[model samples]
Target: MNSSLLKNIKTLFKDTFSAEPVIIASPGRINIIGEHTDYNEGFVLPAAIDKGIIAAIGKSEGPDCTAIAIDLKESYRFSLKEVVPVKNGGWRNYVLGVVAEIRNCGKEPGNFSLVFGGDIPSGSGLSSSAALENSLVFGLNELFDLGLSRQEMILISQKAEHHFVGVKCGIMDQFASMFGQKDKALLLDCRDLSSEAFPIDFGDYEILLINSNVKHQLNDSAYNERRAVCEKVAAILNKEALRDVTHEDLLAIEDRISQANLQKCSYVIEENERVLKAVEAIRNNDIKTLGELLFASHHGMQHLYKITCEELDFLVEKARENPYVAGARMMGGGFGGCTINLVKKDKLESYKKLISESYKQQFRKECSFYHVHLSDGTHMIQTTE
Candidate 1:
């Protein structure tokens, strides 16, 4: 738990409840490498960023669950006994969904009033939703004395987002939010639910995120269409997921799958291998090799996965053109979001200025940029003062 966050929680609690409330934080993640691979049951390398969601929670008197977002300036209330889907852009669905999942898993759910906000850039491919869901679930567990382990908490959060939010995402985001460690990136095998933390020792190098400020509507059909294509290709190959296929395997049955589906399937298969190599490079302290992998991953995403847009590509390309930038790639569900880049620490300001000017000139849009570090996952911070 961060000390400053703990202090904020103490202040918020005294103001809201006339007592100190338990403060918990869950981190949003940036994938160092690996994209479009989680759904295919492949590997991903992601780290929890310093930016995250913080929740100050305490038990409510009534049977209803209530929450207020200090950042969004919104308040919501829901009944735990009769949890119904909320209408009117209910961001509360994420919280309600967690409660529902906890109950369905035979665990008693507790009602609470939560006040929360975060620095994690929403819709910037930084897994802000996962941070919210994880923080809520973790806060509830601590407040209610539930003995759910970290893994169970992750599963509960994943179910909440999938069933309530209606996004068919893989478990990487939730898992990363729960298990991340400072100075390390999680090399996760989504197929086996196992993970190993690799050292992020990019000396004198920093990870920078540039948000194009273009909204990525996950509810859009483009995401679903890509998922459907992957599923169709998997079914044709008689495999459970694209993870089961290799580059050679795809080539062997290339004629059976449509060209579009083949491209999607092949990218996942190859990307999985790249993730392993990236992990090895990190272990070996070979930042240059890992940087090259980032470039290859971007190429695969652009040409094969077909997720990167013009804005995203231009940002990545411009960033890569900088001598100080080792690698750059678009980071999320795509269509529009951020590109993560590895830039020399001393050259960061100049790099940011260059990209900002180039992006403005090319797209007539200003890019939002930020520096991030690997941080601890969800934990409680108690403070007095």
Candidate 2:
């Protein structure tokens, strides 16, 4: 936990609302593997990371809400009854969406004051949006005594993104943010929202995230388009989702769908299998196989799913060229974001320096690096009066 950040949020809320507030630490997430397979009812290996959003919230004296984005130095005020998305609202929409979804669940939420900020770097493919959403929902649940389960809270978070934020994201981000345990990666089945936690031991290698530092507008639209293609292909095959289609099954009907759709379907099918294999690899302590799976996953994303941007590809390629890197792949709803790399712990600094210089020369812009550990999901911190 960031003690300084938590203190700042508490101070901000007290200064704004003139009252002590309930605090929640909602963690951003990193997927070890399994990228676009979430919505297809496939598998994903996601872990909540140490960096995330901290929200301090309290009930308003009246029926009005005020939220402050501490990091952005912005504030928004709204009626509790009129929980609508703000036009051109970036972060406000995430908060409001949570409130809206909670109301949809037939729970009455009073007006509240919110102050939130986070250390999770934006556009780094670390699910900060989900973290923020979860923080607000979790905090609101506590403040209102809504009696919502963690499972129900995650669904509200997911719907908040879909309805208010306009991102048709899958439940993986919210689930991982809500349920992740420390030092473990969740093998989440999107089909039933069930997960098995596996100990994430990379031996001498540690997880490194290389931020390409570029976010194209194509991310959300491209994500929606790809999801549509998956659904269409699944319907054509008469399977419930791509998870039900085997490699041979996809190959059998290769002629029926467009080549583009074929590639998308093929990647989803293969990627789901990779996730299953990844769990086994972890079970066997085969880091090499795990690393190879990461590389293959990126290849599928680059060629088949067609989501990698030049900056992202450059970072992954740089990791591929490194002897210290066991595996590398672009993480998140790619256009430009971070590539999750498994790097030798001893060579971590040198590798990061090399990649930094190389990426600067290649792109003429600075790329960021984050060394993140798996962490527990969203939960409250005791507040001091």
Candidate 3:
């Protein structure tokens, strides 16, 4: 736990509401091998990480709710009976969405004062939005005794994003953040939300991310388009989803779709297989084999999915040259984002310096890096005064 963050939230709560507060920690997540497979109802390998969002919340005595975003230093006030998302999809939209979904689910939570913040890097492909949504819902569920199950909370969080935040996201982020276990990666079957824990042991290597910070204007539209293309192929093949379509099935219906859509469909099918392979390799401690799969996934994303940006491509190409780097690939919805890398412990510094210099020399913008580890999912802490 982040003691300073906890103290800060508690202080904010006390200073604002002059009362005790309940605290909860909701962690961000990283997909080890799966990329963009959730929407297709395929398999994904995700784990909750140590970096995450934390909330300190307390019920007020009125019908109005107030929230302070500790990091943004902004205040949001709204009525519990009239919660609405902010215009322009700001951060408050996430909170408002959660509140709306909770109410929609027949939970009439009273007015509350919430102070929330997180250490998860924004736009670093760490699912910070999910962290925030999960934290709020978890805190509210505990604070109000909503009597919602874990799975119910997960659905509410996902709906909050879709209906409130305007992002048609799959359930991977919420599910991972809610159910993640320490030192383990989840092989989630997105079709049915079933998962199995796979143990991870990097031995001499560590997981690090290199953020490109180059979100393009086409990110949203491109993502929706890619998703539509995949769905179209599935419909043409007369399958429920891409998960139901196999490699051979995709080929049988290749001429029915465009060449571009064919490439996209192929990537999803193969990436699903790669995720399962990655899990098997984890069971056998085949780190090198996992690295090779990572590289292959990156190739498919860059060429087939057409999601990666030049900065991401550059980072992967440069990272691949280092013998210490076992695996590297562009993460998140792509266009421009971070590349998750696995580096030998001893070569961590050199790898960072080399990637930093190469990235700067090319893009003229410094790249950011975050070293993360697998961690427990969302849970509350009883703070002892």
Best model number under lDDT: 2
Off by over 4 Å in 3: 216-221
The reply for model 2, stretches above 4 Å from the true place, is 216-220
Which is better, 2 or 3, measured by TM-score? 2
Model 3, position 49: C-alpha lDDT score: 94
Badly placed stretches (over 4 Å) of model 1 are 1-10, 88-90
- Give residue 356's error in model 3 in angstroms: 1.2
lDDT (10s digit) by residue, model 3, range 119-174: 97677778888899898899889989999988899899989888866677788999
Relative to the true structure, how large is the alpha-carbon lDDT of every model? 0.84, 0.90, 0.88
TM-score of every model versus the real structure: 0.94, 0.97, 0.96
Residue-wise C-alpha lDDT for candidate 1, range 118-154, written one tens digit per residue:
8876779898889999998898899888889989999
Write candidate 2's Cα lDDT for 163-184 as tens digits: 9877878889999999999999
Model 3 weakest 10-residue run by lDDT: 215-224
Q: Rank candidates by TM-score, best first.
A: 2, 3, 1
Positional deviation of residue 229's Cα in model 3 after best superposition, in angstroms: 1.8
